[model samples]
Structures are given as C-alpha cells and as structure tokens.
Target: MPSKKDKGKAKATDAPPKEITQKDLEKLAKDVDKIASKVQHRQEKALAKGEPIKEKKIDPAKEAEMRKKIEAMVQALSNMEQTGAIKASGRKDMGDHKFWNTQPVLQHGEDVTEEGPIDPAVPRDQVQQEPYPLPKEFEWCEVDIQDDKQIIELYQLLTMNYVEDDDAQFRFDYSAPFLKWALQPPGWRKSWHVGVRVSSNKKLVAFISGIPAAVRSHKTLHHLTEINYLCVHKKLRSKRLAPVLIKEITRRSHLEGVFQAAYTGGIVLPTPIATCRYYHRSLNPKKLVECNFSRVPRNSTISAMVKKFKVAEQPSTPGLREMKPEDATQVRELLNKYLSKFDVAPVFETDDDVRHWLAPTPEVVWSYVVEDTKTHKITDFFSFYTLPSSVIGNDKHKSLNAAYMFYYAIDIPEKEAADSYDTARYTKQRLTELMRDALVLAKQADFDVFNALNLMDNSMFIDDLKFGPGDGYLNYYLYNWKCRDIKPHKVGLVML
Candidate 1:
C-alpha cells in the first residue's frame, strides 16, 4: 500500500504523513485514469495537428504484466517518498527520478566543476511543434493577461490553489497588478503563459509560465527562461499533470531557442545550484502573533517584543527619496556594476528595464534611492515589493502584508582605497543604515512584516538589524544547464 501524503508530484510536505486508506486508493486510480486519458489524447492531438505520433504496438498480455509490475513499483516508491526515505528530487538514486533522470539537468549528489548548458542549443525546426497533449476533457490555452476576464480566471485559480504552508494557515495572494508586472516584463511571450483547461466548460485547472531572462552563471551569460507560477487545482494534483505542464513549458522555451532555465522552490529537488534561507523582520508583531505566524519569545512580553522591533520614525539618509523615471539610467549602471561581483545575477540592459523593475509602483513595489548631495550621482538604491499572504482562519486579520527585499546596490569606490576587511566593514555599515530606513518606510506603509533571502550582501545586515531566521528554505535550481554551485553570498539575482 502507498503511504498517504498531500504533496504534489512537484511539491513536498513538511507535515507528517497520514495513514493510507481506501479513499487514497480511489484518488490514485483517478490520477492514473487522467494520465491514461492524456496518453490517448496525445495520439488524437497528433493526428489533428498533423504532427508525428510515435506509436508502440500494444501487446495485451505483455501490457497487463507490465502494468502490474509498474503499479507495484509505483506503490513502493510512493510509500518511500511519503516516509521521506525518498524525495521529490529523487535523492535515493538517479533511477528514482523516472522523469528528471532523463532530462538534461544536474543529478542528485553530482559535483559540478563546470558552468554551462548541459546540452547545446538546437535549431527551432528541431524543437517541439505542438503543445503537449492533455487529458481528453482538457485542452491547452495560452493566456493573454491583457484580457481582464482571463486575468481574473488566473487570479481565481491561483488564489484558491496556489502555494500554501504546511499548517494550511496561510496562502499567497498575488494581486492582478503584481501578476501583470511579474508576467509581462520586457520581451514577455504570450506563448509561455501555458494553461490547461476543461474542454467542456473552459475552466482553467492548471497553469505554468516562463519569461525570458539573460541570467549569468559564473559570469557566463545564458539566454534562458525563468519558470514560475506552476499550479494545478487541488482536486487534480493526483493526475500527474505537473510533469506535463513542466514539459510543455520546456518545449515552448525550446521553440524560442532558450535551452536553459531557472526556478526556485521550497521543496528540495534533484539538485540545488544554490540554497538560501528566508529571514524576516516583523513590523506588526501583534498581528503576526495573532495569526500564529509568530510566537512570543520564551521570556518576552508582547509590549517588550513590540518595542524591541520598533523602527525609526523617519529615514536618516541625506538624499534618500522615491526613485524617479529620470534616475533609471544611473541606477542601471550602479546595478550592473554591483551585480557583476556575483557568480549569478541578471544583466539589466537598458534604462527601460531598470524603470520596469526598480521604479516604484504604488502599493505594488516601493523603491528608494540615495543621492550624493554634492555630485548629485545616484550613490545607492534599494527596493522591495509587496506580497500579502492570506491569514487563513484568523478572526482578526484577513491578510499579512509583507514586503520582500528586492535588488539593491551600494557604491564602494574601488579607487578610494581600503583593505578588503575595511571595505567590507564599511559596506556593511552603509547597507545597515540604508536597510534601517527601509524598515521604517515599510513600517510606515503598514506592512506586517518584511522578508529577505540570505543572498547578496543581505548577510551583512540581517544580524545587526535584528532580522530573525525563518524555517523556510528556498532551493534555487537551473533547468537544462550545468553550473558550479553558487553560495548565498554570491547570488545577486532576485526572482519575483
């Protein structure tokens, strides 16, 4: 019998497993049926679209024997995975990853000494010609976010079925504007916004999206895709639709000549090129405590805890102000120069890209810049974006407003000299000063908390500024590419 767990094929649960029951077997049967329907649908879609469908001869006796063997193996594997003996990333062995092992990604426990694509790029003509087939009752649709109805459908689907915590006490609430900003960045392709919908009712049940990115790994630029927003309705997760969604998106990226990709997840998968810890600074401790998102320390009073985390009333930087459209060019230069120091970072090409990313959007993103009062040069800049988590089952609050630290840069003049130690100490002090003001700004905006990853120069201030380490760990993975592992300190790219 398979062990019962609530994790998706591509997701993991931090909770203890529940005992398997008859209901679990029935659900498993439906999942198997869904997959079978998709296999049948592939042939039909191939004939309809005039694409080749590689067929294998059916042998009834052999098929039945094979099916029994496969079922036994799957059941055993499921039990192992549910027990944490195996992992979503196939930690036990390469063979555990029936799907990932065949893909061009780094294998678990494989040491990476080189940095480059695992496979060379192929011509567009050799890429997949049609979307991956879905179950007969389901069809593929490419979302056009400009359409309000379509946006609303996506919003509704994710609002109900997206990322959730182990306790089911919180869910990510990505606003329509945030989705628009996240999905519709410069050079975004409509084709990459893949959706799986019920053919009978045209209701969306699954979705995965990819956006173009020129990510640099080990200072070598790779034109790749940043894959995100993978979701399947809770009712259909057992259908194993996530693998199909991933394959479809990868195929779509292939058609665009992008052979490499990047993604982040809470679950530990086949391999992580880099792992980062989540750190949080609570602004509204009372709200966090009320929502069970935080607990009062062993020997601290609520009033004392609140006072301990109090931020300054105003920003202390000399010329820090809201970033403007005109400052985009200067900020881009500063970012590019600063990010080059990292092993992995995004290359901000133009002022437009800077404006799109770093410019402030009311309630969506807050950006600030400090000017050199004498030179009028943009000396430093920092930004954070808003993402509110729904406080599930909380009687007092509906949402927990969070501000996530985004890209930032500090001016450490190379010519105006100091030793490495002194430079590092100075940089830390400058960033701490800047981050303190950022805390004040975020608090003023009524954010319940501010969160950041242990990446870039963030480590320099997290301790001095009193940010607490969070239990959540995020693993960063690169798809179809091989690269030496990046330490959290060298990760300069911030994915939304």
Candidate 2:
C-alpha cells in the first residue's frame, strides 16, 4: 500500500483548505501532468528494448482529456476539507465514504476533543464465527505462508499487480524472504494472512494481512494489529473487493483478540491520526534518473548532483559496530526510553521482542550501535531495512534497491527539562552524524535510494543531510480508536 501510493495525501491539500482560484487549479494541473509524462516516456522507451514490459499508457484521444482529469483532481482536493467530496482515483471523502462511514473509524472534519474508540468493543465470542460471504465464483482462503508453493503463488500475484508508480515505470518487488519475515513477527496468526481466490481455478487474486503489535497513543497503551499489504487484482478493483478485504482482515484480527488496528495509506480516508511526507536521499543519482525515479533539475549538471549527496567513506562514531545478541537489552532500554518522548509510539514489554525485531536479519535488516568506548555502554543506535522496486522499463537497471529508515534512537534531553539550549542542539548534531553514516552504509551496500518519513526526530537531520521531499505522503490511521491529530515529530512508530 505504501509503494502503490500514487493516491497522494494532505501535503497537496490540507484540511479546511484555503480559497484557491480557477487559475491555481489550472497551473497545478500543468505541473502534475509534466511529472507524470516523464515517467511514462521512460517506461515506453524500455518496452522497445529487449526487456519484456507491460504498456500502460494509451494514446490520448485528445490532450485535453488527460489535462481535464488532472484539473478535476486539483479542484476536488481544494474543496475536500469543506465538502469531503473528492472522488478521483477511486477515493472517497468522509461523507461519500459509504463503506467507511459505517465503520468505527473517525470521520473527517469531526473535531476530536477526546481520544478513544469510536465504537464499543464486542466480546470475541459475539464476533462472527464465519468468514464474510464472497461472490459465488470466489472464496476466502487463509494462506499458509510457510509453505513454499503457496508463498510462490502469493509472490507472483503481488509482483504482477502490487503497488506501482502512477506512470507505471516502477512497481514494488517484495521478496519471498521479506514476506516470511514481515508476516511472521511475534504472535502472528495464520488466519490473519487473508486472501481471496477464484473457487474453480483456485487462483489467488486479492490479499490483506495483519500482525500483532502494542501501540501507545498519547497516554494510553493498546494491543492492536498492524495491517498492511492490502492488494486487490487490478481488474477486480471496480468490483468493490477492497472493502471486502478490509472487513475480512478485521474479522480475522478480532478473533485473534486484537480489538484495535493501525494502518498507513497514500490517500486520506475517513481521517488520519497523523500524516508524514516521504523524503528520499539518492545513493545512486545516475541510476535513479535513468529509472525515472528522480530527474536532473533544469539548472543542475550530473556531476553537481552527485557531489551534493556525497558522504564520508567511513563512519566517525567512535565505538560504533554491528549490534550483537547481548546488545538486545541495552538497545531495548535505549529505544523505549527514546520513544517515550513522542506522543505516539510502541510499548515494548521485553528485550526478546527487541531481538525479534531489531536483531539483524541478513538481506532484510541492518542494525548498528554506538557504545561508549571508555565505559563499554551503548549510547546510541540506528537501523534500516531493504525494499527494492522494479524499475519497469529501464533496460540497464532491473531494480532500484532502496533502504527504508527503520527504528533508531539517540540520547536526548526531554523538551520540558533542558539543562542548556546547547544540549538539544548537540543532540541534533549527534543525530546528523549517525544519519550520515547510515547514508554511507546504504551506499556501500549498493542501494540506489535511502528513504525516510518525517517522523520522530527525522526533521533534525532531513534538510542537513540533503534529502529531498518526494511526491508521496503516507497517512497514519488508527482503525477503531480516535484521537486528536498527531504532528510529525510526535509520531514514533514506523509501519512497514
């Protein structure tokens, strides 16, 4: 869902939108069309080469028809805060959310003075014992992810139809090992790996999944499921399969004793507890431009672009090294203590959970720590995970290897009790130092891009590290719970 996030979010149009003129909408359309066209052009060029690729762009009946769509999207979003009537890209507003309005999620424009679940919880015994009914031709299936054959089938389905860029130049290429690791975190339920299939042919076409997690919102701690990978075959999206997939996952999660859930999306729905912008630091600028992931700016040369993103060949942290099994205890204490400063975060109950999540998994995650050389005590830590994207039409580059910033912690004084102003500033400097090493490590690992969301203390180093804001925005939503809006820095949890 995060990768196929062309739906865009609030960075384009905020709630209670300001008055925008007809001229403003027209101008925005030109900018949007130009960005979309470049990526489309790159995809076609690759198709003519030897690599087999799907042709997504059709010759427009008239250029005006294409422009009309973009103009309509701009106008619709400009009026969204007041009217809640955006209908482009299969998205619906709060009032037009026929399916969502009936759910327990908070509605858009509802001034939230209290933070709690919108609906009362039902006993698990009272929950539905049967799966939601599907069309006669289709049926529900609980995928056994441990089985090799089934895993292959699920991988094939997603590889062909999962998250794709708007111009179709790139699609998420999640590996089988990654799926096994992400879906089988501590306390994961087999039933929560929900899927749909054609009954006769037994072909998997749609899927959604949830893993157990403990999330803290403001002052309250909750046992909730982290829902993700919600994908429906492209041809069947108009069939209203998305809502069904959501309902099925909720039902499965409820039976597993999870009453609340959290999810991230590229579009604004019902309401967002928090919204974060995606920032990308190019590790391989030349490959990114060739794959249409980024562009060489009008006034910039390739060498200039390359020079701007360069980092130290070696990390400067004195005692930094790869984290070991014994470091789990210190890391948990550090991460939990650090996360407590945020308004929303996860509450880790034990060090075993930390090892399960943060212990380095080769090819899946890379984590490192900074220890006090004199005392031999851990002082700070950082980590990132691998998630590569298929560069659809690039003849030379088959994949755009990306490293997504994950759980990281540093020593910082609480905002309320600061001994000196320089302490906070010093912490920012230390974070920049750690982050620069992360960039260098990502480059050493041969990643084409390093991405991070505007969450936690990321704002401190984002600009200083030369990361640029991306076209995408991820909206954080709490499934059954409701709360006041969460600002970026206040958001601590990062959903995969």
Clashing residue pair totals per candidate (backbone < 3 A): 1, 0
What's the lDDT for candidate 2?
0.78
Candidate 2 off by > 4 Å? 1-94, 413-417
Model 2 CA RMSD to the hidden true structure, in angstroms: 12.4
lDDT per residue as tens, model 2, 261-338: 999876667778877767889988888888777789999987888988777788878898998878999999999988
Residue-wise C-alpha lDDT for candidate 1, range 177-256, written one tens digit per residue: 89988898899999999999999999999999999987888868978899999999999977879999999999999998
The alpha-carbon lDDT assigned to residue 154 of candidate 1 equals 96
lDDT of 1: 0.79
Q: What is the C-alpha RMSD of each candidate to the true structure, in Å?
A: 17.4, 12.4
The candidate scoring highest on TM-score is 2
Error of 2 at 167 (Å): 1.5
How much is 140 displaced in model 2, in angstroms? 1.3
